[model samples]
Target: MTGRLSMGSGQPIKLAERRVFSDSFKPLYNEGMSLVERAAEYLDGPGRVEARKLSRMAATLYAAESMRLTTRLMQIASWLLLQRAANSGEMTRDQVASEKSKVRLDTASAPDNAIGWNELPEAFLALVNNSLSLQNLVRLMDEEIYGRNAGMTDMPPPRRSNPVSDQISLLNTAFARG
Candidate 1:
């Protein structure tokens, strides 16, 4: 299903038949998957030992944060897999669009001033931070590609300033200085 998206100019831009999931997306996908795997390993190994040694409040926070981290990673994985499916033509853009609704892109934030935050295991904190970062990246991409949250209306197109001409102007100025 094709739809027109306005780019703040009241002009309707036709959605392209083929979406370009650029080479950059591959790195993001890889990073997200790697983070997920690393988080799993840590949670199963070092994280478990660390959690057991935590104070009562800290242990509770640890459980909450770890669960949030896992949920965030799952969402990221879902987004990446959906994009890969669309890229490979295993799934159509329309199919991906519909399936996108099922993935929860919104992250659950931990309380900013939680009592045990300072006492949480450093390794767990690192994993949580990394997962949150990945989640944000995936969420941005989802909004951009899927037009989530009226993102099409909110996002402005990148401004172009004729890079070749700009380069030539720079060169002219440099040569004139000599």
Candidate 2:
């Protein structure tokens, strides 16, 4: 899935747009969107009730954790949306690439041992953990597809002067560039 596609013809994938349209990307898109919806539901419903029970210090921590979880999910959703746009031809790959620069894929979670970490509800913690995992997966998949450097230009190798240099060597021995 990370590399070129092959259907037994043994050729490298030539269509650049295939990065978004590939079959492997579909499941990831679905998973990310599902997580986003679930997180929103939990935060607005049961999460509000659970937060009221927290001690002052733990309540503060819960607020921070919820923010992080929301931020992480939003970023993942943004990326997935961009890819979906490309998949459906709503936007060109070039447009997606330009817009993608704003999507941050390096979100991180607070340490498990942080002061009030143990006070968080198990369900809330589970959602945070799941979002973190999905974020990491999306980041890796993005890196594999787009590469480590954004807007990376895969320039072809410099052409060789062997033929010209050979001719030159034949005519004049010491001045060849190859």
Candidate 3:
């Protein structure tokens, strides 16, 4: 039998913050809708199930990434606004660096099998990458709007997946046992 468990008070779990502002170039979400619409046009009834799954995946990844970038951008923008309001004269370098630290863009490695290296449609990897890049650009532009460095942004970490290797290793172990 399943029952709910209550824990004594402890440090609260930290939830990721969500951004409230809407940006103009919302590519990830808009493109997902487009993909869903296109797929729906070609499919019917049960066939739509697979298409819907793809669309949902696309939209979810897009939203997750967009939210990350948007949050960063908002922080940066707010910092800039605060600086402008408080400063009676030009800002110093150290002041700028401190504010910039709040919006640090950390690179994350992607799954290797994210997309086939050489293939059309390319497992939707291109779409994912493109969406991420656009998200970064949006953040960068916000920084630029506030008169910050728009140069030499770090590249995203490579994406890799090992499902094939994992499956093969499992098969080899099974065969050896047999």
Candidate 4:
């Protein structure tokens, strides 16, 4: 069934029209995959060299941050793959909805300790920041499309009363005066 909602003007607005998953999903998929590749390359190459040059404590922090970065990217990749399947009709909307529970998008804040943060390679930090930005965007889309609080906005549209029903109620009340 087509996902359509009636507007105040009595016109039906297609949900897909408002946000075509294919249109936005493709770019996100490409960008996400590319970033993942870039991160992997940097971590394995220059990142490894940089980490080895750091002090023991800083090296440990680098390792932890690298793991976190990879985990975050994996989560994003899983979500994107699911969306791609749904968009391509390989999976139904219901299937996608059910599978969504399996994918947890963590929004944990970045490390606050400045002890070894500055010691981290600038490239690694840039990747982390980029991943965070992408994660935020994905979270927003997920909420808009599937969250329990979907369709709710800060300012609601004005309610339209049915004039005919109001008139009928008024007539009924008047005729009952007999």
CA error at residue 62 for candidate 2, angstroms:
0.8
- Off by more than 4 A, model 3: 1-54, 72-89, 107-178
Write the residue-wise lDDT of candidate 2 on 1-178 in tens digits: 5555667778656343364587766888888899999899999999999999988656766776787789989989999999998888899878988898888876656566655679999999999989988877766666666676464333222222354442343333223223
Model 3 whole-model lDDT (C-alpha atoms) = 0.39
RMSD of each: 18.1, 19.4, 18.5, 20.5
lDDT tens per residue, model 1, 52-139: 9988766766776677789878978987898888887899988988887778766654653565779988778888777776766666
Q: In model 1, where do residues sit more than 4 Å from their true spots?
A: 1-20, 150-178
Off by over 4 Å in 4: 1-20, 107-109, 148-178
Instruction: Flag the better candidate by TM-score, 1 or 2.
Output: 2
Clash pairs (backbone) in predicted model 4: none
Per-candidate local distance difference test: 0.68, 0.73, 0.39, 0.68
Q: Give per-model TM-scores.
A: 0.72, 0.73, 0.29, 0.71
**Best-performing candidate as measured by lDDT:** 2
**Candidate 2 deviant stretches above 4 angstroms:** 1-19, 149-178
Task: Find the candidate with the highest TM-score and give its number.
Answer: 2
